[model samples]
Target: MGSGTIVEVSDLFQNQPARLSFQRRPVTEMAKIVDIVMQHALSHPNVAFSLTNSGRIVFDVPSVSEYDDRLFDVLGTQASGLIPLSVPSEDENAPGDERWTGWISSPDITRGKGDEVHLFINQRPIASQPFQGAIRRGYKTRLMQGRHPIAILSLKIPPHEVDVNVHPTKRDVRLKHSWRVLERLERAIAHTLHSVATAPDSNASSLGIESIKETKTETETETYKKPSWAITATQQLTLSGDSARSLEPEKKRPISSSPAIQKTIFGGKPIAPALSSDERDIHRYSGIESERPDSEKPLSEIINELPEMEPLAQLADSYILVQSGEELLIVDQHALHERIRYERLKEDQNQWKPQSRISSISIELNPKEMSQLQAVSSTIKSFGFDFDIDSQSMIIHSAPAILTTSSIEDFMRDLLQDLSEDNQRALSMEKIKDEMAFMRACRGAVKANDKLSIAEMRRLLEDMRCIPNPWACVHGRPTAMRLTIHSLDHHFGRHG
Candidate 1:
């Protein structure tokens, strides 16, 4: 309010009765204002800008010639892992030719949607599928499936070479040499992602675990069984932060008042049918365990229900190897946990627990995300989040009592990405909530490289018996594979 110029509009669309009748809620209108302002801010960061909603400061960016500084201010910690790249055009001396410049998000940080991948042409934010595709092709297989990277790229093209009048809002533009521009953009994104990048913290890269048929499964506990290795089904499911080895009964988490997410989460629909186990390496390689054992229960459930088959050992921090009766089972820790978490989230929407514990977290959401939030705010709130929103940013004051701060954050961001692009919207509301639960489980579960104690390993395996679907994770990766004693003996010629 000091030296900055102020412009205010009051009583807009008052005379247009039809438009007013169809007008969006105040929150939606504020989001649109914020989206347009943010586009302008990113395009011209050197120009100081400030936004307020109901006299609350949403964002205030000081004029800065350095783009990185502006990004650090706006994106907060997300900007820290960004990799900078400056690709040159042929005409270095020519001022009108297009040149590419901006920062790319490190592989470690990605969004579920390309919404965060901003493209500015001639200092104007514009939309181009070719531009976005180029950026993605650059990342290649580095990002997980359905996940997109965050990028802020700018190009200064000559007036004749770029047409910005393609849309009424000037958000979509046509490049005269679209093919050549895309080739260069793709190469730049690929080169930047490959060179001088952020390496992931762990070496366990089995999140996309292949069904290894003949892979060796060995751990330090392989030499033992009774006391040190094999755990029974009864010894699991006492969720603990301090002690994992407790031999206690599963203590159920109480379901709080309807999910704090006041909407769109649960539809009271029946749980979807469980998927049949995909007989990967275990079936093809050994040619054993193909036929299900004589049991009334599903094969997936039978693996965990066998009284003596608790986790015997952990391998590479990614898998659990167990010598269960006549069969040896290999388990994907992340996959198992994901399946369990997903089912638990669905066991009763009431388990989400009321939102509590105000946090000092704030995030900026674009218009698309804002719309997405409005669409399913109820589902989100039920999961333990309480927040206030302004035009440009959401101030998170509370988080889910069930999940850690970072875990729910990832789930929400991923959810926003999933809800966007209208692809998933073709699904029913029940399916949508199921997907949200899947995402939450994926985010909350342990990763491949996380080291687990024997107790933790046994406990996780024990928890597996509790879920309806236990064979594979939500993405169709097997949670556990079965190998028979007969297969082992046949391989080593012990049977002969």
Candidate 2:
């Protein structure tokens, strides 16, 4: 019996053991191994898999043929760190079976680390080195150096043309025509990166650095002037003679080129030259003055010289209303205040050293807000808003001269909002500056519905008349309009 048992044991060991090798191992040992394999397989569903232990089949999972929950689980895990982005795929004119869909990571979020990325073509995962390299190249300069983007790029190509059995794992795919796909991928990735990294935030005010500089230079130039010898010569010539023929030769000389002749003709003082009868008629129609007081004279001289406008009816709180011939004019009191403020601002902008004033005030902003403020610091400087920024808050050193009397908090809030908004719209700096100027004018102008005293109304009209475009407000709205006596007569049927 022992001999027979020994022979059986030998036979079993050689072919099939009575105590099987599988039975000798702990159940948990096999379970752990199976779990590891299953997890890996679940993580990459697109890749087909089959598992066996000691020639006995264990688990077999089919390849994923579409992007479903399984695919999303795998991709979403891989792209957790990236900024989510989406784009349209169908070109309106393209043929039916040639559509594609895909997503690219944002450059701002990528910041140069490129490992967390995946690609799919026709629902199959691919590890195409050449294609991934192209994506990296697109974001080369837009992101910080040495950082690679995280992306999950997918493309849809005609099924029959692409070979899914490129490798044993089935993760690799081969495209029969990949050049077009490659081009489109490059363009889309490049475009998305450019858009996010460089796009400005909306809410910042628009102001032109160059324009503010130019305006400052002009204001400075206007502050000081050489005596107007031409004015004196013109005044003397008018007093000396009324002969139309004599005035013709003087008028023929170019006003700027004949300074010497102007000095001799008008007594070596600067003022507008005398006008002939015909010239006076032309001047009256065109609104060009035939004469102006010497530049050295007080501004009141010009004001007094102006034709007397009707008296101001009443002073209602702050507004001023005046009558000009047949037209009634309404002006904003605040706008007038703003104009005065603007003039002072201009003067300060022109000076060699801007006037320094102090206020014990501070403004606080969150970290994100501070970053945006820092980004637009140079622009704010151009507007004469000198300040410092820290993580906790922004400190105001000085403000524009005109804004001194106003609430700093309110002004800063408005300015920041305006800048951010304009920046988002991508408006040019010049347009933003013009908008600011308009705001200042609106804030300073006189408000409607306010009564004004006769003196105040007369004063407002006189000042309005001196402005280059007296008929319109700074925003181009008509400040006053005329109704001719003839028109009134026609309206009454008297002309008929």
TM-score of each: 0.57, 0.33
Each model's backbone clash number: 13, 48
Q: What is the lDDT of every predicted structure here?
A: 0.60, 0.44
Tens digits of per-residue lDDT, candidate 2, 331-444, equal 444344334333332333332133355554466642223434655677777766677875446787776544433344534544554444322454454454444454444333
Q: Tell me the tens digit of each residue's lDDT in model 1 across 306-418.
A: 44667787876668898777888888877777677677666555645555555466766644466557665665565456777676566677764444454455556776555
RMSD of each: 17.3, 28.0
Q: After aligning candidate 2 to the native by TM-score, how far in Å is the CA of 355 from where it should be?
A: 5.3
State the TM-score for model 1. Answer: 0.57
User: Model 2: how far is 432 from its true place, Å?
Assistant: 7.4
